[model samples]
Target: MRELLITWGDGGGELAGRLVRELRAAVREGRLVAGERLPASRVLAAQLGVSRGVVVEAYEQLAAEGYLVGRQGSGTRVAAGVADGGARPPARVVETEPRYDLKPGTPDLGMFPRAAWAGAVRRALQGAENRDLGYRDPAGLPQLRRELAAYLGRVRAVVAEPERVMAINGVGQGLALLVQVLARRGRPRIAVEDPGSPGTLALLRAHGVRPIGVPVDEEGLRVGELAASGAQAVLVTPAHQYPTGVVLSARRRTELAAWARAGGLVVEDDYDAEFRYDREPLGAVQGLAPERTVYLGSLSKTLAPGLRLGWAVLPGRLAEDFRQAKQYADLGTGAIDQLAFAALLESGGYDRHLRTVRPRYRARRDALAEALRTHLPQARLQGVAAGLHLYADLPADTDEQAVADAAARRGVRVATVGPGRLAPGGPALALGCAGLPEQRLREAAALLGEAVREAGGTVREAGGAVRDVGGLGGAVS
Candidate 1:
């Protein structure tokens, strides 16, 4: 055993107990793994400025609990099987003091209603029938589908009845199911937004479906281009378009409905629709043309991402095909989670939670915008009207990866839209604002602004060029 110097608040009456608590926590967390030797009592006592007896007493207690073993003259060591010896790989870059993290699609986890959710889970377990504990309907629990239908109807105006709503694992799984069904039906070319979610693009491509990229602009997905793509189906964010925050214009929505009516299918991903700030919540496009659109939603955003609960409201024509697809895809979602979610909805807890989080999210949005305005003043902020992130168009001349790397170096994490592009290349950053605290947002922005400056670019209004104060000439054109 080597001397492990443990630090505590004060080396007084409670010092030994505190030290034992920390040591146990380290063991539990896998920091002090099985077979790892502990510090000698004398050495630890000297290091912590405590009496040796205190350290001895703590070690004895730990030994008694099987956390440690004292071999005669061999010294004390962590007990085998007390914890696994293998440790998770170290972080690529440790965040000793990360000022900001602007990676997109993450919610403010701090705002999650832990108390209410726990209570709901308990109640659900209590009320669930014996049959609910067994292998469930691959389509999902009846109660969840019923509750989800009513909830979606009220919130997004989705025309869903209990029979039409099929719960899946998450949006990813729902998309996979849709892809399988559509591909089996011979619809291979699924059009998507150009700078859409890379993961979603990859998922579509995995099932032999060709993802044709149609460009998105301030008004959202370009309808004319989508028509020109000759694709049988299109995946759209609609309410708040990914990476750009553009709501599908009413004309475009009508046009899309007409196109779908003519033949094409619209796979509506109402992602982040519940978080819209500047406008009244928009109704799902599926409501306008129920027979032509498939509405997908998840608790990933509204609740916690770990829940892995999502639903698909299929058009009447495609309902059976989707269910068959679901049957072949892992049986179904967990019954307990579905029941818990249903309880949350039935008790009006979900809406109550949403009401609380919206303001906090809005404040976060405001903080990020203010930070950008103050620090990266020359940068253009797009997608600010809604969603958890904004697309900041950097000076046209600046390479986005260089900016991303520079930000990483300074403890501010941000990403770019270029790499996500099917046909890559764009001068923009995807700045996520939800996970960061407001006080640190300013500091993070300052670091990011400094990084941009270092990368031979200037900050300015979105459309304005970044004047190269670094003397390399104007970077933005």
Candidate 2:
């Protein structure tokens, strides 16, 4: 048998401990098979230039750990029933990369301000106190909280104070924490916008909260339906509704505020409210009823989602409980990242970054709208005034999934509105316009038009003449 190989670095544990670890690894990795006899203590000790006592100690330890078996006449052998760590599980099937990706819930990752972020990180680290690096308040860094409170108040008209801000991983984590708090408070049911974010619905269900779906229309979430659902709490994306991109009208905002004033809880998800093209985005619903609303915001849309940095502006009543939940959920977010973001906000770098990317995104959105109008004049587009994506309502008879699949085959990917819908609705597609360039977006829209036509949708000419297309079969050019 080959001599046992052991790495004994300086200050690595005792020689016997090292030998025991090596042998146990060998057995677990299947390098040493079951019933394989190890070299005698004396022989191994001589080969490894260690004392025989050290080898004996290691062997005894391995035997105690059930990694080895010793017999009176036979030498120590690898034990049976040991799992092989080297064995691999079946490989996961990977999907092909689409030529044009138009899925929602993602921004242009290429627009991340790497240089400015790196600078902020460096400055934060250099200026940080020793205590700042240690265990921090579960609520978040004080400086970051202050910056977030000020920034939100200024940008989104959110009524916030530093004390009420809780640093969180993202809106997803914030929602989870809110669900936990609500369940404890005996309010276990929450109303969400119908055809809202399916991810949010699944997340609430995962946390044991029953989500009641309320209908949404051109005016936004139907407050009348929400009231009828008998849910005391409701989650809304008011500044810009998801998938549909409709801004809540002034009348609905007043009604929602009235609902909150009458003792309903409002959980406002202020996602992607900073990218309105025609005018400035509206103030948050939380600003109207600060004491009754829990406002959540994240950098996932503005910055890269990979940062996982976000904040929650809570009502005074739920602040402590949410902070405790955050504490227990990974001892709060990373301090370095919090400090870096705070510095960026303080230095006005974040606003500048937004200013730079806003027009670029708007250009992409325009290109997509124009492309859809040019290629598929029959499709009606909505939610184009704000947000990173647009909702294209197809003909009622069009098969949404079939169109999505046909588009995929043509190397153009889109998100179907089916999964996001809780109630039966018209067929539509949510196409993201933030990830690709203007020209690529035009190409994707042209391909999507072809897919729709192939999936039995009517194609209308610019002069409004309808032409019927055949079923899906021929390949897209």
| Candidate 2 C-alpha lDDT tens digits along 106-166 | 7899999999999999999998999998999999999999999999999899899999999
* Winning candidate number (lDDT): 2
Return the lDDT, model 1, position 420: 53
Q: Name the weakest run of 10 consecutive residues (lDDT summed) in model 2.
A: 468-477
What's the lDDT for all of these models? Answer: 0.80, 0.85
In candidate 2, position 35 carries an lDDT of 86
Cα deviation in Å at residue 464, candidate 2?
A: 33
Could you tell me how far off, in angstroms, the CA of residue 424 lies in candidate 1 after the best superposition?
Answer: 5.0
TM-score of each: 0.76, 0.86
Off by over 4 Å in 1: 1-99, 457-477
Where does model 2 exceed 4 Å of error? 1-26, 29-31, 40-76, 84-86, 89-96, 457-477
